[model samples]
Target: MTETHAWKAEDFAQVNAPHVKTALTALQLTGDALEQGGAFAEIGCGTGEVARFVAERGFEVWASDASQSMVEATGKLCDGLPVTAEVCPAEQLEFPEGRFGVIHSSWVLHWVTEIDEPLRRMARGLRPGGYIVLQWTGAHPRSEGPGMFGILRDIAGSPKWKDLLAEAQPGSYEYPAEEVAKVLEEAGLELVHYEPDLPHPFSAKKTMADLPEMRERYKLAGFATQAAALGDRGDEFVDEVLTAMIRAGKTDPHHARIVARRPAA
Candidate 1:
């Protein structure tokens, strides 16, 4: 599955505010741990929402994403702000060593096939005493066990989707907070704060109430990648999955947040 095409820029832009809000909260929690006015970078900066928030706070922001449309959208959204947007994949990230004091990524790292290299690069990109803030979906709601993807795996059953899910087992990773902290520690970062589970930023009841529109948005944003994995049958597959999710009253997946710091020299 082409990572870039999995999410449409316009569709993602619509539901981006809540995520930006969460990332902003994480940034605020970092507080004085980050050097004031220091360089900041966001990986997978879809639509530039978080970058805009950071730039508006007077930080020089650099953001990158695999999707060109997202990069372009970010550029336009951040126009006139202290921000730069580039088209780059996580594995290809190339930042100067010890260049940034704050690095942020939201709902992005799991997409990368390999986490170690990019993580090592992120660690290297931070200046001593820098802060690295990350957020990603940790696990699916037990209530929705197998949820939408379960239907896909059973019906469509494409090898690509299977492999993608198989790599991490299930569509999304639910890394334990301790494991994530250990990964950071191995990369020479000290854990400052960790939230293993955060409340879903959106309301499931409201989403279910507006099931049709929500399904459309999900088709464009969340299921696009899955659709791409399904090829010609993608649309039908997504429709069925969304219908199932609505019927099952599945809530949004839980998220994990981590704030770690590179030790002072």
Candidate 2:
């Protein structure tokens, strides 16, 4: 499960506003399963921006995330709004069967390791005609290997941080559209839309040009081991990783998107 304490809610909200906005736009194109008396649900709701936005659309929204800080932030963002925020991991989500019209997750899916269980759970939560819109990618949507996590690991294994981050297991996994489709199929969700390397708003990916800021992001994004081990020193290590990413042009990553639905029958 993605660690919660390492996340900075405000920081995440600032960097990922575009992603939530894009997800909201995709949800707008989805079918009207909510008309069947099902509410809208968002998995991995970082700061609850999507929940707030959707609630404003006049739908009761249920949102969850593994991070308690994130969940709390969601509550703050959607205060007095028709939204319910909870602290739950995607894999352990226990929504009532057929309770949601749309189950959405944006930049959150890539961090998940137990992919099948989460997909299965989300599928179970969907109403018969309900849909799920997912956005994810591999490393940089354009690159073949070694994303931010790999860079962090490489820096951790270097001479300077090798001993300091010895127990650091920092890694982020983003999957491709085809891979996501296969998982959705395995979970019994019929594919509706597939956009590979979706470039539109996804181009809003955080660039690697700002080394210090990027390092701050890297450390705060579930790098508990490194943070606990080196404390303030982790910043230097993250800077080196960011420098390497800049050198390799791993600046603008995109995400592949897929929209799928449960069978109406």
lDDT of each: 0.73, 0.72
Error of 2 at 259 (Å): 0.9
lDDT over C-alpha atoms for residue 25 of model 1? 84
Q: Name the Cα RMSD for model 2.
A: 3.4
TM-score of 2: 0.82
Name the regions of candidate 1 deviating beyond 4 angstroms: 1-3, 33-35, 139-174, 202-213, 227-235, 243-252
- Tens digits of per-residue lDDT, candidate 2, 212-263, equal 6666655665454467567767666666776786776665554677889998
Which segments of model 2 are wrong by more than 4 Å? 1-5, 31-37, 139-143, 166-168, 200-229, 252-254
Look at candidate 1 and give me any clashing residue pairs.
138-174
Q: How many clashes (backbone N, Cα, C below 3 Å) per candidate?
A: 1, 0
Give, for candidate 1, the lowest lDDT window spanning 10 residues: 164-173
Error of 2 at 103 (Å): 0.5
C-alpha-based local distance difference test score of model 2: 0.72
